[model samples]
Target: MGYSVVKMKIGNSLEEDIRRIEAALEVVPSGKNLAVDANGRLDLETAIEYAKALEKYDLFWYEEAGDPLDFEIQAELAKHYKNPMATGENLFSMQDVRNLIRYGGMRKDIDYLQFDCALSYGLVEYLRTLKMLEEYGWSSRRCIPHGGHQMSLNIAAGLKLGGNESYPGIFEPFGGFADNIAVVDGYVGLPDIPGVGFETKAELMKVLRSVAE
Candidate 1:
């Protein structure tokens, strides 16, 4: 299930991540989409070095090459890198997504457009984001929804995005509401169950929130 362009953090050093990547590669079979998210942890030079080191890994995209706002820098990185690039979750609006795609020097440097619409906006904003992307000629584009996992998958499938992102951080104990998610074969399959198809553990939230109150 490592296909469909999934990313995992490698932290500061490439040595360990390289080994980890090797181990993962063994089980990944072949022809699965894959990538990495550095979380902007490395300097440009370091990021470049690391990217080169993992060149054999053939990452699908690298996240946050630098700052999200620094389109110039990201574009520069993209120019040098072999794989595609993606970024979001730090941006606050659809305009940010548009600007990245329309970046002056690096317009369209972004291969995949990643954006998030929180639940507060409900379905309206979610649909709005989709409409906006379509209006901008991104109808054939791939967008990774930020806040809504299942919702994002639905949108991705409908819009024919590269694929939706997994909500849980790779190592987090809370494996998100959808544990059945798989990245294999370069595609995502939505659950057939009704609604979002995720069963939230009601008591789990209460247990965690008890310490807050």
Candidate 2:
């Protein structure tokens, strides 16, 4: 309930999605941002249409409206809309993310990068990707990483990234912060426990302890 940002899933029906988003906008107070994810499901034409329709909602970002690898589609959509664009969650390598920067029509002033460390061969490689961002003139602040795991949380803490994603109501035991921790005013304190801190979460700790022993 303390969340300042909300991301909704779309791409089901263009009209329905627009109405839904518009309805939400009516309830969301000013100063709060609402983002929407299409999960890379829309085709280019549909994506462009939705982009025009959704412009009025003033979304924080419209994410992955087409295939994750279709940088051209994303780029085209970007040209038609003023809202921020976000993608790269499915990209698993520095080169892939580099391509997004080079060809994805992402604007550093308003776009977001969502690279996931755990999905992309862990933090070692993710560090390289972060460095690549610097060469491309993108800041770590533009990157709100994709994975919702403790590993991403630790990395965000260590590297001072923009933020980490979370699925608080899904993927129990593995998709959220330490159980007792609350998202206070949209911020949560990281656990002091070492090495990704899974042990601090009761359900997650049960599995971790069982595997370690």
Candidate 3:
């Protein structure tokens, strides 16, 4: 209930999505961030139209309007829209992410990078990606990794990342923060237990302990 940012999924139907987004906006209250994710499913024209229609909402950020790897379309969308845009969840390598920056037409001023640690060959590569971003003048605050798990939580705290995504009550035993950790003012403290702290999440640790034994 202390959440300040809400991200919704879109790119299904233009009319329905617009209606749904408007409905979400009505209840989101002012001063709160309302973001949306299209999951890179829309075509160029539809993505453009949706972006145009979405502009009036003052969204916190619009995410993955078209194919995740299609930088050309993103560049085109950037020309017509000025709102903050986010992508890179599907990009699995640092090289592709670099290409997105060099040629994807992403504006650092208002765009976000969602390079997940697990999805991109784990934390080692994620660290490399962050370093790459720094060379290009991007800050670690611009990143919010794609996965919601204990490992990412530890990494977020250890590296001072912008944030980690979360899916509350989903993926039992593997997709949440540490057990008993409170979400204070939209934030939760990481566990101090060793090795990603799986032991702190009771249900998850039961399964993990079995694997270890």
- Model 3 residue 186 CA deviation (Å) reads 1.9
For residues 128-152, write the lDDT of model 3, one tens digit per residue.
Answer: 8888988998888888888788888
What C-alpha lDDT does candidate 3 achieve relative to the native structure?
0.84
Error of 1 at 62 (Å): 1.7
Give one digit per residue, the lDDT tens place, for model 2 in 29-142: 741378899999999999999899888777788999999998999889888988888998999999999999999999998899998878987778889999999998988989
Off by over 4 Å in 1: 1-6, 30-32, 104-110, 119-122, 146-148, 155-160, 167-195, 198-213
Global Cα RMSD, each model: 4.7, 1.4, 1.5
Clashing pairs in 1: 1-184, 3-183
Runs of candidate 3 with Cα error greater than 4 angstroms are none
Ranking by TM-score: 2, 3, 1
Global lDDT scores for all candidate models: 0.60, 0.86, 0.84
For model 3 the TM-score comes to 0.94
The top-ranked prediction according to lDDT is: 2
